[model samples]
Target: MTTTPPPPQVVGPAGAGARTGSGDVAATLRATKKRLTSPWATFAAVVLAVLWTIPTFGLLVTSFRPAADINATGWWTVLTSPNFTLENYQTVMAVDSSQSLLPFIINSVVITIPSVVLPIFLATLAAYSFAWMQFRGRDALFVAVFALQVVPIQVTLIPLLSLYADIGVAGTFWAVWISHTMFGLPLAVFLLHNFMREIPGELIEAARVDGAGHVTVFFRLMLPLLKPALAAFGIYQFLWVWNDLLVALTFAGSSNQVAPMTVALFNLTGTRGSQWFLLSAGAFVSIIVPALVFLSLQRYFVRGLLAGSVKG
Candidate 1:
């Protein structure tokens, strides 16, 4: 008679577990929101934002102030005795002048574009292979690639320069391009591989069942999901190449035809050490493209950075 009750029937709905999970998630979100909206949190956030913005705002104000005003007082004094001029920017950008930064800007574009593109293209392929393919020594090869990231660029610069010289590309844009691509590869491969591995294995298995080859899966399925990662790495590499002074100085020397804006800006400091107005203007000019690029692609960059941080 006691056994006849046969395990008192569980009366809940089939989705009870799912409902519990959703409830926990909602509670977590609510707690997080509460913490973020607390008065202390709001005050801290405001303080941090103001601290971060002050230096950049000061730099911007200095860029517009006249040379005499810059030399005479701090940028904060502009609140009382505001004076502005475009002469610094004009002189820095003037065409056919010894101090013109326009050509170096063009050279930066040339060096940066290929440096960004080549590493991304190659890293994507390498990451795909490492993530999905089965091959002897694959894990070891990946470890080796990851290890290369720790090797300081300074250590290899001399040897790499010698190699470039032997290959007849030293003192040219090719040398800088190759060096950047080389330095960028290990980090790119590591990040892209981490992102790719986070993708569902079921998708790849389903594609394989549909008779799709590696190339088909990579192009049709993976590429679309990889846009965030690609944009992230592209932005990083672009900024690095664009703002680079050491590589440009090492490989391209002071030749304006091959030197980028950083080298030019550096030389500007050396030659016109007293010209704070011109230096400020050139600094702003150098940062403009990077700021624009970052602002535009920031969403993708955030998503890419969050890759591999969670699991379902």
Candidate 2:
């Protein structure tokens, strides 16, 4: 009353006009920043991509080039000399009716598949029991389990060898598979248990109330959800088993009958001087299976990473 209605402050074109002006300014700034940063990001990405891929590209080129070309000519010459040959691969595989890649790669699969699967199968069961079921000394037991990783591989090598010898599995594929599975169990269980614990507790209880047994719930609900963790572990274990030389050399023979590609590749170089040329091919061959493994399991690997990111 005293102010006689102070101009009845209300929504007006002035207020709307000011807000619209501010919005335009903000949008322009954002667009400008994006435009300015894009080139720098692209440049950095190009540099990184080149650095990351050059060595692998060189290896691929060397594998195709003649040994002399490989030794004398730079891999960069694939751009110029442009000469290509399969002779190096032929030479590496020619002697004694050996494909060089075939038998050793097959042997690696035999050793690695079982080793990776056995540990994962056993670890999943153990992890489920550890995470969901209440039992005696559970926490202490888990700590002890995790602590096993601290034990050096060398520390148990002799004991494991002796055990393998007693079991008559020494120098056999079983020996290496068993050895790898045993060594890999602790970490596998640890990783899986941690992943399982992050699952909502109510889901498990709901399964329980539905009259589903623990085994049923695990196989039905938990296993499907653990896909990511399983994939992550599988890729890691497969690579480990595929590339392992020490365990393979110790437990399996060097005859290439049982030895994996890693051991086979090692023997490719000798007093004839380093067969660095074959190394280029052999390294790529060895990586193929691991790449396939990752590609096949990558979906779950991503899920497993995100599973624990948010709490209920």
Q: CA lDDT of each candidate?
A: 0.83, 0.80
lDDT of 2 by residue, 105-191 (tens): 778888988999999999999999999999999999999987786676777788888898998998889989998998888878888
Candidate 1 lDDT, 45-108, residue by residue in tens: 9999999999999988998988888888999998988888898788778987876778888888
lDDT of 2: 0.80
How far residue 213's Cα lies from its native spot in candidate 2, in Å, is: 3.0
Candidate 2 wrongly placed segments (more than 4 Å): 1-28, 35-41, 90-99, 295-312
Worst 10 residues of 2 by lDDT: 303-312
Q: Which candidate leads in lDDT?
A: 1
Best by TM-score: 2
